[model samples]
Target: MSDTSGALVLFSGGQDSTVCLAWALSRFEHVETVGFDYGQKHAVELRARDEVRRNITARFPQWADRLGEDHMLEMRGFGAVAQSALTADRAIEMTEKGLPSTFVPGRNLVFFVYAAALADRRGLKTMIGGMCETDFSGYPDCRRDTLDAVQTALNLGMEQDFIIETPLMRLTKAETWGLAKSLGGEDLVDLVVRDSHTCYQGDREHFHDWGYGCETCPACELRAKGWNEWVAEGRPTLAA
Candidate 1:
């Protein structure tokens, strides 16, 4: 039997996180998924997470035994401080600094910290997140430097050797799609397109080949652009 122990993924039931989840499952003998109720405007992604989990387990039963239960955390005050389209009911727009309205302040920081806490308690040493700088909406926390700093801080503060992994950190959105297809083939791609939610507005009605969303929001635009670019390049093998 596989060692059946490895890492936890900071899963958001979005395209990137779902791909990260698949990546973690491929490498780890055991994997647990964590989501946060951070008072985001698009809480629908939480529901989508459940559905995506079911789809993954059903389609990839070989991983069922090692795939642990989902962990949902309540961050009651996140919306009060984050103050973005993800937490507010306003039109999705960009900030003066070129960041999209969905850029929640220190959101990824809190997420990584809490995920580290969970890992410490569970004796897990690795935690994976899906934050990407390429093809992103200009969120500062999604950058590689931020993640690196957070990793260092997490170790110093908790006195634990936790290895935070960002599998999608460098991959473009199109490359992410390609990586998913490469890792798990059609099943993974299907789950991402049909189940993952990346819309700033949580618009589920507008379905596209890339995925479903408002199709005009920053998230959808980025996804669509990536898909187009991928196609233009003959859908070449995207580097991880």
Candidate 2:
């Protein structure tokens, strides 16, 4: 853990970002959270982000000491057009085809743009995210190549030294579960399952054999599959 390295996490109050948040907390001396509200279907997830931040602050009072100022930043406006199913007026059929309707155009680009500006202001060099290629439905932004390109662009555009870190980029959802369990406590991962929102339709209470995933949407199916595999392997599954 480098005491000089400051990290800004692109958090979304979902399972992936929650795990990434915990990971950033362990490595960076200064860990800050930046969330975006692009008018997604699950607007409640933004509320969940605030709840998770409150829970984190309550559990780790020392975290306040870690973050000097601008600890948590939330940005809204610049809403995504109805290009994808995520914000379209009609419901998106959940599938792995081309790209999901939930795919917000230039979402990562917008997020990193703001994060890089903040990093430059704070004299930070690292921006962390939970974009994973293994479990990505079809979003181009979640790919390793896309991240690499974006990193280069951010540095050149801002003329500031910035490194985008995707710790779970190559890991599967099951593998991400393992990482979260190891980095944060197992309870943190359990909190992710119970509290994080990933449903495309904003279904929070829907639960299956795999926790709170809606059990219907593609995101839920993937999450449920990963959790079931983790449980079947007896790999210290989430608490019930």
> Which predicted model would earn the best TM-score?
1
lDDT of 1 by residue, 1-240 (tens): 233368999998899999999888888888999999988877899999999989888999887777886899999587687788778776677778887777888999999988998988888888999888776778899999999899999999999888888888888887988998888887788889999998878899888988889888787898889889877887766544
Best by lDDT: 1
**lDDT (Cα) of model 2:** 0.74
Error of 1 at 56 (Å): 0.8
Candidate 2 lDDT score at position 79: 62
Q: In model 1, which range of ten residues has the least summed lDDT?
A: 1-10
lDDT of 1: 0.85
- Each model's lDDT comes to 0.85, 0.74
Angstrom error of the Cα, residue 223, model 2: value is 1.2
Q: Candidate 2's error at 142, in angstroms?
A: 0.9
lDDT of 1 at 187: 77
